[model samples]
Target: MAKKDKADKKGGKKDKAARKKDAEREVVNGVFAPLVTQTARSLRTLLSRDLADCGLYAGQDGVIQALAGEDGLTPGALAQKLGVKAPTMTRTIGRMEAQGFVERRADTLDHRLTKVFLTDGGRASLERIAAAAEACEREALHGLSGKEVKTLLRLLLTVEENLQSAIGKR
Candidate 1:
């Protein structure tokens, strides 16, 4: 019975070790989903830190860029354009308003509806935010050549389409 107990303990330890290795292997190469998610999260953290110097958050830059292309969009319209939820867009816009980066205007046709516009500060901040974004991209792709960057972008877009298709099927 003593020998059997010892053997069982050894087997249990081996099983645990094997499970740990499997988890590690999964993260390393088993599936692309975990890798893609980790890459996205890491990139967001890096970009957020860099954007902080410009007084903007990671996701806020996208909103600014969208607004820059077309100003005075309703909150819902902006949310749809950015692919963000309505509540999230509202919170972001509220923060930007508090920071003096955006302002809300009553829609001329409908007083009840509000539209978002970039404030003077927001227009000026665009240059800095753009530079920060470029710098972050350069840093992230420091070792990659132009061809490699293009390849990476193409691969990412393909992955995005695959995921979108999967979501649509669901």
Candidate 2:
């Protein structure tokens, strides 16, 4: 009976240690996800302010840059390139068209299809957009060394890939 009581005590200690480790892991995971999310939100807010000076929004810059690279792309293609849904792309295009930044045209080859083209205003804003993005990046990386920046980028890419893989599995 004495030996059995000692064994139970040892097992309880192991269980307590395991629970402590699990709680630590949970705390780390909880902090990590919120930190990443808050960082992203803060960066977007900063970038949005900079972009506002250039008469653009946070997301509109991506569309402008994409259209600058490929002059005419369908809304569906743009959605795929930007990793957004088709409806969202369509609404963005509509807003941009209203703002005179982009215009939709019937595809020359396929009349049934519509392609989005950057307007003269959009073309002219490209330089300011680039400058805004650069400023945002500089502010974000203000205190980080090049090595630190590279490591951060690598780690973020790994995290993104892991999340994407999990999403794909789902």
Candidate 3:
């Protein structure tokens, strides 16, 4: 296992001890996890509803958002940006191309290299979709205090960074 993964596992001791002080703590009751399912479902459901006019899915939004800043990217680059398998990226791009979200063309500098770029529709959809996502996140964090939200975001970002660093080693 990677050093980061080892460190991630190392935190269990602290977490276990911290929870031991509580007289009663909430427990999940599912084959999967309530926390995981709730957030995932909420994001997907909200995005689907809010972005319906945009003609995009929750998974496809990442590519559009990435292309919004950068003019174009190679399949390998897109895969990295989305943190997905190369084959999965290929399929997603193929579907997006069919949907006219993105287009592919041979690179001018390297004829063999094909790059992906967003269509005008893709660009327009992204701005609204992003706003919708921001709203969704705002709603999700509504009950939490500012400090609690910041801490939660910090912890989630740490986990993302740690796993990303470990993934790069592979």
What TM-score does each of the candidates earn? 0.79, 0.82, 0.71
Q: Which segments of model 2 are wrong by more than 4 Å? A: 1-26
Going through the candidates in order, what is the number of backbone clashes in each? 0, 0, 0
Clash-forming residue pairs, model 3:
none
Q: Give Cα distance to truth, residue 163, candidate 1, Å.
A: 1.5
Predicted candidate 1 versus true structure: per-residue lDDT over 42-68, tens digit per residue: 778888888898899768888888889
Cα lDDT of all candidates, in order?
0.89, 0.94, 0.83
Estimate the lDDT of model 2: 0.94
Report how far residue 165 has shifted in candidate 1, in Å.
Answer: 1.9
Per-residue lDDT over 1-170 for candidate 2, one digit per residue giving the tens place of the 0 to 100 score: 99999999999999999999999998897699899999999988998998898778779999999999998999999999999999999999999999999999999999999999999999999999888878889999999999999999999999999999999999
Clashing pairs in model 2, backbone N/Cα/C closer than 3 A: none
The best candidate by TM-score is 2
User: What is the lDDT for 11 in model 2?
Assistant: 100
Runs in model 3 lying further than 4 Å from the true structure: 1-34, 162-170
lDDT of 3 by residue, 1-170 (tens): 69888788779867877786552343333433567678879878987778766777667888888888786799889899888988999898999899988999999999999999999878877778878899888887889999999898898788679878999999
After TM-score superposition, what is the CA distance of residue 157 in candidate 2 from its true location, in Å?
Answer: 1.2
